[model samples]
Target: MLMGSCKSLKKVNTVSIRTTKPRKISPEAQNLYKRLQETTKKGYAFGHQDATAYGIGWKNDGTLFKTDVHEITGQHPAVHGFDIGHLELEWEYNLDTVPFALIQDQIKKIHQKGGIVTVSWHASNPISGEDSWNRRGKPIKKLLPGRRLHRTYKTWLATIASFFNDIKDDQGRPIPIIFRPFHEMNKPWFWWGKGKCSADEYKMLWRETVDLLTHEFSVDQLLFAYSPDAFDNREAYLEYYPGDDVVDILGMDLYQHWTAKSFSKNLNDGLKVIAQLGKEKQKLYALTESGLEKVRISDWWTKVIDQQLAHSGITWALFWRNARKSHHFVSYPGHKSATDFMHLAQKDYVLFLDDIVPIEVSSEAQ
Candidate 1:
């Protein structure tokens, strides 16, 4: 059945495509996906981290295109024990006009290094820019606003699904890509947000996106993650939640505030809620987005994640940034950096490093 669309360009699936031509999924691939979905598995993350909003172009030039990617790759997870690496998406593949093929190779590199890659999407950004991913890095409002001539963004789903198929694993299985669209849903800062979108409206968009991506596009290997910023409380967290079935992975983005009392409470409360939710759903979980703003001490790292993982249903943690002081984005005070979180695995869950494969995470994270 065709999903409903908004009267104007405000329609949930609107997007500015690079080409007017449409693509098709081969019959064999379609059959493979249908069979795969049966055992496709739902993946989850524990203590994951996002690289958005981080400016690292040497001396703050913000041209971080090449330099920052390498730096982030080397340091962030090394300090943290992350199983996933999340990046933003763009109209082009990479620095060159290699299309989406090169991007798939890069994702495989991340996976070869023991982490799956994720590309993010926002509702507002529609214009294709010079950047390799994420509409050339333009804010969604600037790229698209107030509805346009074309009111649907459905084509993007097809584009990404095709990219996923082009990339495969050692066994020839398509590289399972984790696509996180419209993240930080509860945060009002995003253009799709701005404190708008009724629950039904949001759900409609989410469901439509999923239906087109999974059923229509046949990207069965993709994992959908619903990530919200740290909540003030559970009620705030559930406000933008897309519900359990629509989401394969449930995670949150949080940070270490400079303040002692406030940050501590936020961290503790957030972890407590994470544990509860993971157990309730029997899902794999993560502190999806995290880093320290100011605090910096080696022990601070292990303690923070260890405490959280020490809980009943917690899994791995991914810290961000490898630099000291200012670069404490994903690292904690005592943890030294994101890599520091890994050491605590033995002490925390002891079982998270438990099942180290994507298949296991997919099954458990669900």
Candidate 2:
């Protein structure tokens, strides 16, 4: 009895270090990180912008003619894309402008269905309520610290933070989001684009925004993506990169700017450049946005996108929206290219709904 009592006292005094305890990364973020690591070992995922909320070829006519991925190919895309352009202006959820409440619901549904969501922002020039390309406003420097719009920018970031915070699954855990802000900055069109601000200024803006969203707001559910337009080489692409620490994903938006024959070559070269950079930096990379607007080529999916992505260690490639019949990316049922797209969807390397690894929904319902 004395020996047993002595052993119990010793057990109470000893403390375990638990060296194998996993870091407290959010479940969604951890799932995405593991999947990205596995995707390089597996294959790339396919995505589409504004896919479920709306589509070009057809709309829900109360029948079997919804042209979103499932309606056309019997499966939803592995990734769903959204944008927050009009939210800064505090507008209701419109076609491109996703209001907070609507987005929250959409995120829940998509997550429940075992899919991923990526978001982009086309923040209007804060000085002018015009489009994103409106250069009539002051330099991007004005939005950084110690400037007139700095306070306004903080309010915008708070709004975005609140929006993301509201995005909770059934268990109330924040959903993992790939937040790509100020995309296509390498192009001199948007207010934050090149020629509008110096590289140092742009980097400051990016870092400051990230610090605000991550540190200040304590939002750990987001994976920041730095995306630029297609550049000739790595030097040009990395010119505006914020830093390795701030960015979790490296992506580039490449559209078919040249003729059909040159489309594959241009996109392939850009992908090669991004792939090399991602490998060197040890970051996940994606074709954040691309599409032959109107998709004139019947085999564009296989010949252009698939051919270029072949053997590339890309995580995902998201095509632009199918807004209207005149300007659409994916083909509708009975469309000339729909058959070719079916082949693309069924390929061993390309992944769609059934092919994607399922994300574990929070078992703790909130």
Candidate 3:
């Protein structure tokens, strides 16, 4: 009895250290950090943005869309290694068979294979409002914005926090899930985006959502991100800017297969904006979402991005679809590619995993 009591008392008085507590770094993270150094100089001169240079990863539509998970993961040729991973939850994807609770198990699967998980948390969408946007299911359009239905946002958010609350990496530390919400808000349509709410409303929603998750739910594990769609002009970028405090990284979703000139223009415009933003705000920039429409065609897979790699602002770029031809998400629905497409085989692009880290136990949240 005295030994047990003494041990318990010692536990209460002892200061915990990372040395005593095992710090198991995931192999994916280990390689990613290694690649970060290998791919760049010690100083900040960006390189010719080769897609393969930095990091490579893919987004899995979580539901078990492919019953044979092995067939999908690592089998795709476009995604090779060390890119950040995403276990996205959309009505079109997995969330049907497995509940949100089981997501960590699958994330573990990805991590075991050496990859980081980017948790896809849709902000407000037409089918689901903020209040109704948790992993449960989408809400009706009419029930969004203001009123009791909106309050459901808190309930659902709490549910999500409780769900991810216990998730840990291989080392038992919380998995560094980059929670990207309201991505591409500049795209006027999506619920939590331009069409549904005014800029002020959007900012308020963001602030409120961050407050709810960061404060109320105690989701200290999340790395808050804002990814806007690639813009034709730089104005759209400014339109959705959530300011310095809220956004962690700047990114865009684009397809190099779209028309070489136009696509190049948009991406360059984005790079310029990022350069300016990075200079002023001190933030890291990335082509968060990217892809070529056709599997066998074009250097766009690398040309568009690495062209600006030598610049200090841009860090990483992750392709949209896997190497598989059928599951190609290159150009959304109805946007077909021309037959006999030209392919750029020696693609080089960077996946800047080393640029912005997710967290460092930021003062233990609130």
Counting only residues 3 or more apart in sequence or on different chains, how many pairs clash (N, Cα, C under 3 Å) in candidate 1? Answer: 41
Indicate the residue-level lDDT of 159 in model 3.
Answer: 60
Each candidate: RMSD? 9.1, 10.8, 12.8
Least well predicted 10-residue stretch by lDDT in candidate 3: 1-10
Best-fitting candidate, scored by TM-score: 2
Model 2: residues with Cα > 4 Å off, grouped in runs = 1-27, 57-67, 94-100, 359-366
Better of 1 and 3 by TM-score: 1
Of the candidates shown, which would achieve the greatest lDDT relative to the real structure? 2
lDDT string for model 1 (196-258, tens) is 445444554565566566667666666566678778777776766655555655667776766
Model 2 poorest ten-residue lDDT run: 1-10
User: On lDDT, who's better, 1 or 3?
Assistant: 1
lDDT of the structure predicted as candidate 1: 0.46
Model 2 quality (TM-score): 0.87
Shift of residue 322 alpha carbon in model 3, Å: 3.3
Error of 3 at 240 (Å): 2.3
TM-score of 3: 0.60
